[model samples]
Target: MLPKEAYDAGHYVGVVAHSTANNGDSADGERNYESTTWQNAFVHFFVDDQKIEQVANTDYICYGAGHTANHLGYVQVELCQTTDAAKFTKAYAMYTWLLAKLLFNRKLSVVDGVTLMSHAQVSAKWKESDHTDPIEYLASHGKTWANLVADVSANYKEMEGTDLKLQTLILYSGDADLQVAADLAQHFCCPIVQVAFATSDLLLSATTKYQVGGASAPAGVTLLSGADRYATMHAVLTLLGK
Candidate 1:
């Protein structure tokens, strides 16, 4: 689930990766990362080869950023190590895609590092850890923070064009067609938000429908749904182009 106040207030997200794993979202790595309950170290999102797992609640604080305010203020995302060339490309692409979706949903800039930062950079600036996991990793791959930011712009711009500014709300369930909503968010690339409670009727610029039986849509919501999660995900990926 997305954060309550964080999404409401548009909190920045910090992206970090472990350098030692040398592979994508290893099961052993998830256990090690999640099991370290002793320290104030935890992340909200975990990125790997083909999946982006939400480990912690985003509304709360993650203690992974290495600084007090950084930890408390930003959403933290941890990536499995990316040393292998093929693994890194896949992971990096997924990271950017997930990030563009998240940032666009949060009303943050997809291409802006002020909102998205590397763990190494944030730690170094704030005097946190040794401060060199992803930096070293990026250096080895001939990519830099600059390259990453550029990629965000390219990826997001290519995927989405128009900017939506409505207070976005996403009502997703494992059973319901969740990817449908996530796809709309990916392309419209606006700051529409999700809410725990909503009014009896929602007013939007487009036409949308609800899957439930009792609820009602006032007007201006449209219908355009997908078949499955995979197709739905890709559909949203091309939302901006539409």
Candidate 2:
């Protein structure tokens, strides 16, 4: 389940619902909603034997996707039955409707290349030992995760810039700080600066000198300052590297 804020914040991308038959025997009794007098009886949406049940608001997070709270970002829908042989026509319809609503409400293009990932994509731990869900069932029906990702990526603008770089600065002070700075710098393909200034206040001052590639600080370069001069310098250096 997701809260309205999550969707409004662009924190979540799409929805996913599972068929109950995949969990165990189909004859298992249904969820007893009478036990709890809540506004919604089931998940945000449910794909059952015959139809898609809109039980709750799509904005609320439900009790699915295992233990990871971040998974709450996804709109989770579950089917009443779980079996490999279960027909997914109803599930597909629900998914289509959910996507239509999300795209329309969010002002996103229907062909926008945004991902609709499975729980497995968010956490490998869920499938590391033995557990598997949509992936397994989808595979049986001639679908693949790669295909899904590709489809979303092709239609979503947000998915296009996966390789964009963010510039940062990292400063080093302690013995290990230089190593950390260097490692991060190498990763970001950026410059690393080494500087010495009086007082922690000047450590990060925009006017502080910085060394990069054994070169002195260029003209117009500014420095950062803070209470923990050394740590702050290290952080700046690391960020620069990044």
The sequence of per-residue lDDT tens digits that candidate 1 reaches over residues 1-242 is 32233432355553444343354455346746576661546666777766677776766666666655344467766666755788778777877776666666666665344666677666666776765656666677788777777776676665554443244444433444444665556544532323223344443422343321113322443323346556544444454354
Candidate 2: Cα lDDT at 187 = 60
Error of 2 at 174 (Å): 75
Candidate 1's error at 47, in angstroms? 1.3
The whole-model C-alpha lDDT of candidate 1 against the native structure comes to: 0.55
**TM-score against native, each model:** 0.55, 0.41
Could you list the CA RMSD of all candidates, in the order they appear?
Answer: 14.8, 16.1
lDDT of 2 by residue, 69-167 (tens): 334455655545444454554444444455445544554444322334465553454442223445666565566656544443343434223223225
lDDT of 2: 0.46
Candidate 2: regions farther than 4 A off:
1-13, 21-42, 66-72, 80-86, 108-115, 125-131, 146-242
What is the alpha-carbon RMSD of candidate 1 to the true structure? 14.8
Of candidate 2, the 10-residue stretch with the lowest lDDT total is: 157-166
Instruction: Note the clash tally of each candidate.
Output: 10, 44
